[model samples]
Target: MIALIDYGMGNLRSVAKALEAAGAQEVKVTAHAKVIAKAQKLVLPGVGAMNEAIAELKKLKLAEVIKEHIFKKPFLGICLGLQLLFTESEEGGRTLGLGVFEGRVKRFSNKLKVPHMGWNNIRTQNSELRTQKCFALNNIPANAHFYFCHSYYVVPEDKSLIATTTEYGGEFVSSISKDNLFACQFHPEKSQSVGLRLLENFVRL
Candidate 1:
């Protein structure tokens, strides 16, 4: 079963619907710790403030539960969900993140736009999501374009988790992967066929 972590606010239903559309056997949106810990895969989807998301995770006492599960299972984060995985964020006064990835989330200053909302191409960097045993790509194209909706972006201190890159005014970090943890700055639920394929890929993982 795939578990979608739900706090007070999130793109809960849209993500759940998209997961089902992608043919996931089971999908549950919950804040329950045992449900999250027992799930086969976990999807962390958010569309709100950085601090608020972290606060809710902490409130549910599922923050550490998620961190523990990521090491042994497939864990995915989206948009603001990706941001919270970092060590800190400049969203609202240097707020701290979940500290899974060693870095900080910074706002865009490239003069392109505050909130970069549109379709963009993705270019892969250091990626293992391609040839993993259960994650067979078959005829699917890797590094294809997906939907993006965010103002701030992650800047990993290590630079190794960067799986792909997308441009907005300047080249901003798009997607990242570390072990079992995969994340994207875009929303797969809104990216149509490309998005659904990505979700299917994650589910199969």
Candidate 2:
């Protein structure tokens, strides 16, 4: 079973439905602790401001639950979900994150577009999740395209955790992994075929 956490701030229905269409045997969207705790794998999806998301997460007492899941079970975070795994974020006057990864979310300082909303290929930083292999990914080359929509990007202090990277204004962290956890700044659910395969990999794990 795959648990898609309902944090009251994510694109919930879209993500849940996408998981079902992507061959998930059991896909659940909920805020219940027991249901979440029992799942073999969990996914955290978030949208909007970081501070607001953190506040909601804290209110639900799911913060510690999330921490526990990442420590024990396979975990995947998407978009703002990925950012929340960091230590802090500059989204709203420097908000603190879940500190799952040692880093901060930074806003693009470049003169280009603020929110990098479009299709851009991703460059693999390592082979943690097989971004270069055909078994888990198809046609996901060194820089295969994926969908993205965000103003801030995560900056991990440790370079070893970087799984893949992308360029927007300049290169930034596209995806990251640490043991049971795999996170991405891009929305694999909305990225069409390639994205489906990415989600499939997480579900398979």
Clashes of each: 0, 0
Candidate 2, residue 116: lDDT: 90
Residue-wise lDDT of candidate 2 within 1-205, one digit each (tens)?
8989988995788888888887889888988788889998898998899999999989988898888778688888999899999999988898999998899899998797878999998887543323322223434556678899999998898877777888787788888877767888999889998888887777766
Per-prediction TM-score to the true structure, in the order listed: 0.91, 0.91
Q: Note the Cα lDDT for every prediction shown.
A: 0.81, 0.83
Q: Could you tell me the lDDT of residue 88 within candidate 1?
A: 96
Error (Å) of candidate 2 at residue 35 is: 1.7
* Colliding residue pairs in candidate 2: none
Local distance difference test, candidate 2: 0.83
Q: What lDDT, from 0 to 1, does candidate 1 have? A: 0.81
Q: Model 1: which ten-residue window has the lowest total lDDT?
A: 129-138
lDDT by residue (1-205, candidate 1, tens digit) is 9989998766589999999998998999989989998999998999988988888889889889988887788988889888988999998888999998899899989666778888888765435323231232223465677788788999888776677777687677787877767788998889898788888888877
Give the Cα error of residue 145 in candidate 1, in Å.
2.2
